[model samples]
Target: MNHWLMKTEPDELGIDDFAHEPQRDFMWDGVRNYQARNFMRSMQPGDHVVLYHSSCKHIGTAGIVKVTRAAYADPEQFNPDSAYYDPKSSATEPRWDAVDLCFVDKFPRIIPLSELKTLSALADCALVRKGNRLSVMPLSANEYKAILATTNR
Candidate 1:
């Protein structure tokens, strides 16, 4: 299965939120970036994902989640009240897509971004590269393995 990394603010929707409701399918939505949206569209059910927490005090890879559903139109884009809503988007022709992710595991401790940058396996990863802010990005098998290895699991 393919591997990927998706970033989210801990306060918005983080590892803990998924851990609390492990069985629920969490809709990963509100991605406004075209590249990020394309990445989501490429995901398939059963693919693994790295759950990264950013824009918070402790920024890092917090846990593992797996795609439980493939990409579909983002419901938030149709809601006028949602901050992610787009008037140009229509139900028949969606401009954004979202996927469903289910919790897999929560790391004992966060694997900090500083440490990730030092890993040779992730040296070329967009996540570790400077100025790369796309929320959803693909991960090489080596990079995924290396990140999980840091958890000692």
Candidate 2:
């Protein structure tokens, strides 16, 4: 299965928020960037994800999630009242897509971005590349394991 790093603002929907959800899962929506939206569309059920908390006091990987559902039309895109609504989009031609993700495990402690930059194993990770801002990015299996190893240490 593919692995990915999905960034979210803790204040908006942190790992804790998912834990409290009735089904401990939520639809990942409102991705306006075409590249990011495409990444979500590429996800499949059971794909692994690293939940990264960004734009927060502690910017880091906070937890893990598994894709519970594949790509589907993002309802928000068709709702005029929603912030993510696209005026040009219609029910028959949705402009965005979303996936369902289920909480897997919260890290014992956040794997800080600063710490990530120091790891040689992740030097090539897209998330660590300068000026890279895509909210969702692919990660190699080795990169995934390397980050998980940091939590164990």
In candidate 1, stretches whose alpha carbon ends up further than 4 angstroms from where it belongs are none
Alpha-carbon lDDT, every model: 0.95, 0.90
- After TM-score superposition, the amount by which residue 67's alpha carbon in candidate 1 deviates from its true location, in angstroms, is 0.5
RMSD of each: 1.0, 1.2
For all predicted structures, in order, the TM-scores are: 0.98, 0.95
User: Candidate 2 regions off by >4 Å?
Assistant: none
lDDT of each residue in 39-135, candidate 1, tens digit only: 8999999999999999999999999999999999999999999999999999999999989999999999999999999899999899998998989
- What is the number of backbone collisions in each predicted candidate, taken in the order shown? 0, 0
| Candidate 1 residue pairs that clash | none
The lDDT of model 1 is 0.95
